[model samples]
Target: MAGLEVPTWDPQTAMLIGAILFEAIILYVGYGGLEKLVGPRLMELLVGGESGVSQ
Candidate 1:
């Protein structure tokens, strides 16, 4: 039987993982910013005319 061995580290795999993580972080931040910037405008467009109306 073969002896157990520890897994080896690979630079390419590390870089790819790092890139994916970076991209995810960037997308999360960008999406949050975009939502904040556009949310009010979209809400206004959808519900703008009812502001002065009585319940």
Candidate 2:
């Protein structure tokens, strides 16, 4: 075994952050797509039949 050392800042850090950011973006896009695909159906199921405000 050997002594461990703290990591210093470098291009790898940027790449790691970028990868995480990209993953987050992909997840956001995927969820957004799914929402668009199913959001109406969900809304209809949850609140479509009811009027939110009475005139």
Q: Assess every candidate by TM-score.
A: 0.70, 0.64
Off by over 4 Å in 2: 1-9, 49-55
- Tens-place lDDT per residue, model 1, 1-55, is 3678777879999899999999999999999999999977787787775353447
Candidate 1 at residue 31, lDDT? Answer: 96
Give the C-alpha miss distance for residue 26 in model 2, angstroms.
0.2
In model 2, which residue pairs have backbone atoms overlapping below 3 Å?
none
lDDT of 2: 0.84
Displacement of residue 7 (Cα, Å) in model 2 is: 15
Model 1 C-alpha lDDT versus the unseen true structure: 0.85
Q: Which predicted model would earn the best TM-score? A: 1
